[model samples]
Target: MSLVRKFATVASGTLMSRILGFAREMLMAAALGTGPVAGAFYAAFQFPNTFRRLFAEGAFNSAFVPLFAKEIEANGIDGARRFSEEVFGVLFSVLTVLTILMELAMPLLVRTIIAPGFASDPQKYELTVALATIMFPYLMCMSLAAMMAGMLNSLRRYFAAAIAPVFLNVILIAVLGHAWYTGADSLEVGYAMAWGVMAAGVVQLAIVWIAARRAGISIGFRRPRMTPNVKRLLWLALPAAITGGITQINTLIGTAIASGQDKAVPALAQADRFYQLPLGVVGIAVAIVLLPELARALKAGNDGEAASLQNRSVEFVLFLTLPATAALLVISEPIVRVLYERGAFTSDDTVLVSSILAVFGLGLPAFVLIKAFTPGYFAREDTKTPMVFAAISVAINITIALTLFPRMGAPGIAVASVVAGWANALMLLVVLIRRGHWGHDAPLMRRIPRLVLSSALMGAALYGGAVWLSPWLAPPASLLAQTGSLALLCAAGALVYFVLAFATGGADAGMVRRNVRRGSAAPAGTEE
Candidate 1:
């Protein structure tokens, strides 16, 4: 399959998960609002979720996929299986120990890192600690699942890993539904949601595990040993983990800082969900597919093919994300109000979350560009460079967020993240070019400015449409009216962007067809 098709396979699955995720968040907002329970639950969830990204997505896969792909090429399936089992055994043992340690330290963690501000409220602090302990084991399940996912991706099977996240949303939504039906109190709902997260982790793990089995790789646990391969993996993974989870690190910093303000944690969480939809769909798909594809190309000594994959991945991400950034910036309030302003969620909450979403929108391109550029390093086993840059970005995020939190509140925290993201992304891109690892090819260079122009024009149209449709999007508007109006505005924005994109050759039918077609080579005329 071509890179685009592979991305599409993952993206389609991600889109499903994101849609269901929206439903889950909507129910969560109605159930908890931006109250103490909501803040506690989101804060508690952030710990395990951050670790999941760090261990599973950031560390394991960033380091594992390239190694796994190379293992298959050199040592074949049997070698790959043995290597996987070794890594799995070590991962399982490490996670078990870590979970126990974290559980014991939950109270301290909550008081210090997770949500220091919760310390003043004993009830909220206790709830956060308990919720985090309940969800902490989720890290083990997801890390193991990520290993399986890396194996699947290396084998060029994208659907199962990409689709596995749907179960998380599905399970959570079910828990919220039951809570709503029972008219549960906020505390009761919080406990139920944490358990639901635990259940979802198990379900998600089972999904990827079963998929790995079907792919003919049944990895049984082995005694944890310091084998050469395992040691090498650990070495590469340590830095890559930091690099992979930089966004999570920044968000965690923001979360801890935002925790100082009442309602700020949940408000940031809600805004995060909105931006994460696009990030997960485009950035994640590119990140997942690009690493393995680039590794394979470079392994075969096809430098041209590697460069093409990287360039096209960047192009594809920008093509989709720039428009999304525009929409989020132009109609953030209408979008937030339509989706979230209901039941316990008030209009004031809408205003706060919308502002945060707009700031996150400004960083959308940078977020996805990091995904596009990092494979250039990871594919060559140079995880440390990205790791160094990620650390710098984290420092930037922490300084700016702390400096601004007291004055600008949650939006300031959001701005800090955007700035950090752009810094991380540009650093990676510049290093790649300086090292002669990546180059801005002719097509990519030509298309980006045009894509930016198309998105700007689309944003202007969207702004006008939002103004014209204000009545249908306002308070007291029926849900159907608000949804319809938002949908119409989005459709109009997309039409304007795509028409202009094609007209000015920012994107073209030939490029789309080339991406969708089979094989990796760029056919003549694939680029204008």
Candidate 2:
């Protein structure tokens, strides 16, 4: 399928999920606010999510997809099926043991690895541990879900897997809303959210399983055995894990530093929810859809096609991300206020979250580019190169966090993350150029200035629109007015970006129009 249509399929699903997720967080803010309860829940949520990123999103997908794609290309349907079953068996066993151990060691793990924010207050620390214990097993369900997702992607069934996350947000929102309506305590609502997380994982797994069955790739597990394929997956997964670890270390560092400052960790987490919307919609969708295609192209020795896909992915990411970064920065305050300034969420909390959001906005494009760029290396089974670059970025993040946190508070850590992201992106780009995997294309070169100019115009329009609309949406606002203002501002920004992009030849209106018309008719793989 065409890249644009493939991206749209995944992106539309992801956008739905993100919208529901935003509603979930809004309910959470109204229900728990940005206090100790919110802090505790954020801490608990981060524990599973950290591993989710490490195992499900980054490490597992990186190691599994390329290998699975290669196997399917070479060994046909049955051979690939056996490889998936073996991998799943090992993954299930390891994750089961790990989950059990983690639950048992919840207190110490929370105090040490995840929630340093609780250290000063015994009650909060204990609460975080308790919630974490409740949620810890989510890792097992999600790890399995990741395997299912990988299998589905290999079969080119992207819709169900992409749409699964929306169920999570829906379930969480329902649980939280039910709890609040029944006048449940904040702690009770928090527990409901935790339970909802586990439930969502189950649902996600089931959805993908159904998709696999329909694709004629239903998997069954046998006794865990150390087969050569399992060992090979392990070998690939280990370095990928370390690489994933380096990326995650920055989160751990941010959590550690943010813990010392009251409410900073949760504030940062809330801000991150906004940043992740675009990243998830564009960055992750592209990565998931592009990686398997790139792997197949490389395995088939279609170097020119692979290069074209890589270049297009980069262009696609830059075209969307640059303006997103600007809009997030421009509307950070009103966005936070409109969504979260209620109940226990004070004006001060809004200010804090907005500041962090702006700081995060600067790095938004960089982070997305990292996702777009890293797949190039992984598709070739060259995990080590990205690992080295990720290590350098981690070190840079650590140093910057240390130096900046004292001076800028939580926002400092956010800035440091952006810097680290750029560092990683640049390093990856440099290595790709050196290795002859990517280079300047005439199309990209010609499009660069136009893209930047369009984005700048969008930025100015968005910032001005937000400023003009803010006073009307300020405190003492009705929910309708606030919501309406935000909707209008976003519409205006989008219109400006698209119009300027089309008029200036920054983006192809006809291509986008054709993509929309073609819909699901686009090919499932990269166009040669």
Candidate 3:
């Protein structure tokens, strides 16, 4: 299958998960709002979520997938199987011990890493510790699941891994609904949600494990041993792991700063849900496909194909990113009002959260671009450069966040993140160009200017459109009317952007259509 199709498959699945995520957040807003309960739950949940990103999302794929694919290509299935078993043993054992230790140290973890501000409130502080302890084992489940996902992606089996998160969202939404129906208190709902997270993790793991079994790559654990291959995997993974830690550390700092004020943490979490929709669908979709494809291309000494792939990936990301950025930034207020301002969530809350969302919008393109560009380095087995850049970006974030949080609060923390994201992206680009790894194709150079201009045009349109649509999009309006009004606004913005995008040569509907058509004709079961 073409990389475009792979992207489409992964993105389609991600779109479902993101939609379900919106649903889950909407329910939470109605049920918990920006209350102390919501704040405590979000704060507690960050422990496992942080490690999931650190080990599974960021480090594991970069270090494992390329090496796994190399093993398959070089020494065949048996070799890959042996390596997988060893890694599985070590990963499971380490995560098991870590989970147990963290569970015992949950109070310290909550006090130091998550929400030190809550320490003043004994009830909130203790609740956070308990919830975090319950959720800690999820890290173990998801870390192992992520390895399965990497394996499936390397084998060109994208659907199972991509769809796994939908089940997670499905489970959480159901649990939240049950809690609401039972008229459970916020704390009860949080405990249910915490247990539900662990349950979803197990289901997701089983889904991927079954998929792997069907694909003739059943991975089972052996005795944990430091084999040469496992040592090499760890060696390569260390820098990537540090890079991932830097990413999570930035989040931790932002949350810590935001935790100082009431509702700040949940407000930022709401903003995150919106921005993450685009980042997950576009940035993550590109990153997943680009890495293994680039690795294979480089290994085959096919730099031209690798360059072309990189160019189109960047162009595609820019084309998709610009409009999402425009919508999120321009109509952010109405979007938040329509989606979240109901039940316990207030107009004042909408204002603050929307402002934070807009701040995050500024960094969206940079985030996606960073994802698009990094595969070049990861594919070449050079994790150290990104680790260094990530360190520098964290320093920038900490300095700016510390300076701004005193003055501007949660939005200030968000602004720091945006600035740091751009710094990381620019530094990565400069290094790529310097090392002769990046070649700016004509289409990329041409389309970027057009994409930016078209987005600016769309943003202006949305600003005016939002004003005209505000009455129906705000509180006291019926849900149907508000939804319809928001949809109309989106349709207008999408129409304007796509027309300008096509006119300016930033998008090619024809090419994507052809790819889809060809993709439709391919056999479903084959890797190709």
lDDT value, residue 221 of candidate 1: 80
User: What are the TM-scores, per candidate, against the unseen true structure?
Assistant: 0.98, 0.95, 0.97
User: Which residue runs of candidate 1 sit more than 4 Å off their true CA positions?
Assistant: 520-528
- Candidate 3 lDDT over 27-133, as tens digits, reads 99998999998998999888788888888878777889999989988987788888899999999999988888889888987887789989888999998888888
Where does candidate 2 stray beyond 4 Å?
Answer: 242-248, 509-528
Better of 1 and 2 by lDDT: 1
> Candidate 2, after superposition: displacement of residue 417 in Å?
0.8
Please state the error at residue 135 of candidate 2 in Å.
Answer: 0.7
Please estimate how well model 3 matches the true structure, expressed as its whole-model Cα lDDT.
0.87
Residue 336 lDDT (model 2): 93
Clashes of each: 0, 3, 1
lDDT of 2 at 365: 82
Looking at candidate 3, the ten consecutive residues that score lowest on lDDT are 514-523
Q: Arrange candidates by lDDT, descending.
A: 1, 3, 2
TM-score result, candidate 1: 0.98
Candidate 3: give the clashing pairs: 1-528
Q: State the lDDT of candidate 1 residue by residue for 1-528, as single tens digits.
A: 777878988999999999999999999898788999999999999999999999889987799999998998899889999999999889888999999999999999999999999999999999999999999999989999999999988888888899999999999999999988998999999999999999999999999999888887999889999899999999999999999999999999899999889999999999999999999999999999899889989999999888878888888999999999999998999999999988899999999999999999999999999999999999999999999999999999999999999999999999999999999999998889998888668877888999999999999999998989999998778899999999998998999999999898899987787567665543232211
